[model samples]
Target: MSSTPKRVLVVEDETEIRELIALHLRREGYLVDDLGTGDLARTQLSKQPYDMVIVDWMLPGLSGLELTRWIRTELKQLQLPILFVTAKTDPEHVAAGLDAGADDYLAKPFDTLVLMARVNALMRRKSWMDSFNVESEQSPHAHILIGELKLDRDAYEVYLRDEKLDLTKSEFKLLEALMMSQGKVLTRKTLIELIQGDGVNVVGRTVDTHVFGLRKKLKDHSELIETIRGVGYRVKLLNG
Candidate 1:
């Protein structure tokens, strides 16, 4: 079977902004679809699958937050990237957007460069999702079993032995990096660079803070993650 060309749906009430994104994305070699309202977006999404959805926070009918919740709750298996582009940059708004299932966001009025970066990030995430095993009723779950610590990829969840560990986004990425290395010590610089992506401003100490939080959250299994004194950290393997 032929692979379908990756398509993105741009849903925004503002005509200029909608066209602007569609134009830029099409120029970047992606098949782009444009819709003016949240209702139209819902209709198109129901009819066909999109690799990613760029949505405006406010709409005449259904709001972006509402749409995100619907997508997350109703379409559990469709892990399409949701990117919010809007003027609302308040911390509460950003948090609400993320909590509502937006994979990433761009605050307006945003630079075209920044928007493109976010778009690329979303597309990269979509590519990752496409490569994931999605044939079965259940998604393939990956477990990096390092001794008592476990990192679950399918659920984006983690645990220590049988006990659950709640980790923030950064903390989880840090743990995943260490667990994947499996006894190999990963430097703080490497961990931050891997998790923060290319352009984000992240310092070495930020990694330390995330590691500290991760260690605290892991509780009794904290020993599973070892600090290498002058180096960084490692997650000890289960069998070795």
Candidate 2:
């Protein structure tokens, strides 16, 4: 964790639930930001940065999914931890929430323990990634150049043929890991740990979806990332 307390934004339409969530977070000593509508949340998000956000699946002004998409696509805060809370407990609903970019989900009427557990886990994951990036930046060699693809660890950016690439945080990390490993194939579980932090229970399939998105963004250079059937993925070995 940083020297300062992590700030969290809670976006729930219910005043009671919003306050309750904030109360629980404050009890744990986190700074809290609250919003009752998605639009207001969006505006606040643009003006400030929060360490995490807890969003309701249903909200006024915009649904949770829409707000999540806006954060990812517009704000480009792909690394921000999002915990989606909703009454919808169906499998498809859960899948939709994850696909829409939530790092985790909690059903309504949730126990504070479970909610706090997820929140703590996400914070840990964030800390781990931050530390990992710092370590990478400290490395004397901070770049991987493969054909038109280049990932610069110094600037934390990716470029293809000199054009900057807009990749989500996970996608950028995934590509970096793969390109760095080069010929070594990485299992889904291994890739999860490499990107999301060990013991972070992200659904294994989430790696697939992230890879799918990364591949699409890579466009004509997408062929460089090779799927290894049941094993996982690897960057194809380059010829001498």
Using lDDT, give the best candidate's number: 2
Report the Cα lDDT for residue 92, model 2: 87
lDDT of 2 by residue, 1-240 (tens): 456899999999999999999999999889999999999999999999999999998998788999998887789776688989899879888878877778887888999998997888788767755655565533433677888888886455899988899986578768877886788798897677655532135567989998999999999989999999998999998776
Question: What are the clashing pairs of model 1?
Answer: 147-238
Q: Which candidate should be chosen as best, given TM-score against the real structure?
A: 1
lDDT value, residue 143 of candidate 2: 72
Looking at candidate 1, the ten consecutive residues that score lowest on lDDT are: 130-139
What is candidate 2's local distance difference test score? 0.83
User: Would you estimate the TM-scores of all the predictions?
Assistant: 0.76, 0.64
Global lDDT of each model?
0.74, 0.83
Tell me the tens digit of each residue's lDDT in model 1 across 102-221. Answer: 767687898888787777765664453344345223234566666666677756778777888877766776776676556688887666555443223567877778788987898877
